[model samples]
Target: MLAFDISGSMLKIANDFLSTKASCNILLYQGDCTQLFPLRSNSLEGILSISVIQWLSEDSQIESFFKECYRCLQMNSTAVFQFYPNSPEHADQFVTVANTTGFHSYLIMDMPHKTPQ
Candidate 1:
């Protein structure tokens, strides 16, 4: 497994926490999500992002990020991201960009009672 973050300090904290557990298969690295990932094309089975995509403030950056994700993932693979959008429009923008980047995108709301803002 591979994990990356733009913050080295965050990676250090993660590394420290992982060290307390049994042997882990995860490889931690410092990387920017908006830039090219340090991985070969179609090399990854899937990717996961937790509260990360919200940081991409520009459409170009989002497009680049999605493009890289699509390039890295194998055919029929998935990339799941959990993010808090500032508004409904922001969330829609993400899905639109992902779809434009050739991904069959879907938006799932965990809280059905609350409307997405």
Candidate 2:
């Protein structure tokens, strides 16, 4: 498994946590997600991120990020991104970029506050 984070500290923390539990080899890298990853094409089985995508300050950055995600995945691979959009327009932008980059994307809302107590 491969994990990327902008914060070196977060990557270290996740690596430390995973070391105690996970049996599979996990590679951790700290860098901007918008840039091309060091991995070879069609090498990754999956990509996952939480509260990460929405922070891209520009549309081009988001596009580059999605393009990298698509390029790094093998055929029929999948990625799950969890982000809080600033508005409906922001959400639409994400879907647009994903489509342009060859991903079949969907948004799964997690409304914890709306759940019945």
Candidate 3:
């Protein structure tokens, strides 16, 4: 497994935690998710991000990030990102960008009762 974070401190904390409990060989790196990842095209089976995508404040950055994800993932693979959009328009932007980047996107609201802030 490969994991990365923009924060060196976060990576260190993850490394310290994973070293004791993780069963698999997990490689960790410190890098910006909005930039190109140190990976080859069509190399990854899947990608998962938790509360990360919303940090990209610009449309180009989001588009670039999605494009990079699409480039790295294998055909028919999925990249699931869990994030809280600031508003409905923000959520729509994510879906729109994902679709524009050649991904068949879906938005699954975990809590339908509570509206997005």
Which one wins by TM-score: 1 or 2? 1
Window of ten residues with lowest summed lDDT in model 3: 108-117
TM-score per candidate, in order? 0.92, 0.86, 0.92
Query: How large an RMSD does model 2 have?
Result: 2.5
How far off is model 3, as Cα RMSD?
Answer: 2.4
Model 3 residue runs over 4 Å out of place are: 112-117
Candidate lDDT scores, in order, read 0.91, 0.87, 0.90
Candidate number with the higher TM-score (2 or 3): 3
In model 2, which regions exceed 4 Å deviation? Answer: 22-24, 112-117
Q: Residue 8's C-alpha lDDT in candidate 2?
A: 89
Q: Per-residue lDDT tens digits of candidate 2, residues 1-117?
A: 777889989988997899898575878888898998898999989888788998996999999999998999999988998888888788889999999989998876666234677
- Specify the highest-lDDT model's number: 1
Clashing pairs in 3: none
Once model 2 is optimally superposed onto the true structure by TM-score, how far is the C-alpha of residue 10 displaced, in angstroms?
Answer: 0.7
- Assess the local accuracy of residue 62 in candidate 1 as a C-alpha lDDT between 0 and 100: 96
Which residue segments of model 1 deviate by more than 4 Å? 112-117
